[model samples]
Target: MISLLLVVGVLVAMFVAFNIGGSTTGPAFGPAVGAGAISKPVAAGLMGVFFFLGAWTLGRNVVTKLGSELVVDTGVFTLTTSITVLFFIGVALLVGNVFGVPASTSMTAVGAIAGLGLAGGVLDFAVMGEIVVWWVVSPIVGFWVSLIVGRYVYDRLDELVAMERSEGPLFTVDRSGSVPVPRVHRTTNRRELAGTATVVGIGCLMAFSSGTSNIANAVAPLVGSGNLAMNPAIALGGLAVTVGAFTIARRTLETMGSDITELPLTAAIVVAAVSSTLVVFLSALGIPASFVIIATMSVVGLGWGRATRRVPAPAVVTGDGESDDPLREGTDTDATEVPNPSALFDPLTTARIVLMQNVVPVVATVGAYLTFRYVPIFGF
Candidate 1:
């Protein structure tokens, strides 16, 4: 019976990991893919590799926090209870995927476990409080940093990073030596190659951040239950994430790369760097960072700042013996310089994305609480 229960728990854990992969890959690699710096398959491959590296390292800290520290007693994480918690996380993330929005895997996972802890009467208020504080703080930090970058540095960076994809393959094999070495295509300019590399490198960074924060979301329950050791469970979860990266992640890639917002290449890079750094720092402190929320807020901030760029405040408006009507007094060129409010993303679409991300976690938290509180089979 124990063996069968363990198997069931592992399967459920993998289901959660799979959804994590699909939901995270978009935010990690969307900019690179959208910029034609790399193809979707290459992006997926990089995501799998970097994600594992992160999970095997700093990710352990986060796993320990979520699996054992959030609840007063790890004993509450029986195999049945673990499976139930994972089911709520997996289903909630899948709903986000269906709507083409990347959900917060960390938030959903934490919510489920928090619910279980509360229902089982073993909730750790201090740990939960700390996590909640970081969750609130990180997104605000990401937004402000991104906003400053957009307002002061975006235009210059965009011009410097402009990349035009050449007509053919980016690289070709040169078999002149004993080993076949890859060489950049002659048609690709040095600047273009450098820009592409930078974009791809940032994508890898985002993937690593995702792994650090998200790995625990998949396997923490089982790890806390003592049904599976940490290393083996992390490896299994990484494998499931890899599978998801190669498959269902494709749809999410499309949504993020193009549909999420009109994110310029420079803006995307800025957001990725800011959000990824925040997640990694929080994960190192044993907190489950809300990557989706941080990234989305970063996007909005970047756009808002860019749209509000300070053009010449119009000589007429300065009340210098000029006409009172600023619009009529300014040159036609000045009149055409008016900033459009919707320069970066559609308000309605952004609202929908934000709403769904928050709703999924809430649903998971509420559902887990009700199940553990009312269902005798969970042994809560």
Candidate 2:
């Protein structure tokens, strides 16, 4: 009983969801795969599984919010209108990826939907306000939690999770037994195995959180159109995600794990755990959280916290309480110079970085709002 328009709408939704998978796979598994703790196939497989689990359970609430609650009247979501709304959201993703901004899918989806609702005079301010509140608060919460972990616990965690890859293959298939059994290499110690497991496990957790947050963005429009039921929509979106994970995520994994930043295995694991857990919690509450911002803030917080500990004092005062060794203070130091740890976090640099990220969502929201309201092409 599916109409042609309905089928086309579903295809568009799948396209968006597929991209969601590709975008999410990088953050979810790039570290583990990049660090050689796991292979790309393994990472992609895990992302598909965990993403489904998350979407099947906690992600449903978000779907409800987007499909039914955001607009007081579901009548606004005609098949054509739904496609139009989703198109804009997809464009936001394109803009982000092209411009190196990696925009928040949650924010863009909401903005486009809100725009449609506003144009139709059915936008729910209460729901929009609630979503906005979480958007504002969640990052702050992540920063503080990460700040704590960065300061008091990161060192101990690092000490415990220090990763040292063993020589030879970590495990090899042995045909000596009745069935193929994986045997640890003679060089692979228990500690090294545990370290590898930790990294891969955190990657899986991040994948789960990504599913929870992103599933709704992929299929909410289809669900709103009444062409698909919730469960079917979720399954379709999950399948698209799997396709994205296997195909496009390969490149993203390489970029994040190798090109963007070089991080120690322990630090990567910690950041993965903190950011993913926060995202899962938010998705459970039907709020779409930003993994990009959360993870970035976590890295910053963890680094800043670690840096502040045992910071070199501001004034290395002599017995006369004067500045110590003026020549060494501001002059270009030798390559071997041990700089003060107090220089660990630059306030201006950090502030600018965070501010720049915030600007993308703001621009997206305004753009979507204006486009939906004023564009006569949508036939709203």
The numbered model that scores best in TM-score is 1
Tens digit of lDDT per residue, candidate 2, span 218-298? Answer: 888778878789999999999999999999988988886321134666667777788888889888888877777777777
TM-score of every candidate? 0.90, 0.87
Decoy 1 TM-score against native: 0.90
- Where is model 1 poorest over a 10-residue stretch in terms of lDDT? 329-338
Residue-level lDDT tens digits of model 1 in 30-57:
8787777788999899999999999999
Q: What RMSD value applies to candidate 1?
A: 4.1
On a 0 to 1 TM-score scale, where does candidate 2 land against the true structure? 0.87
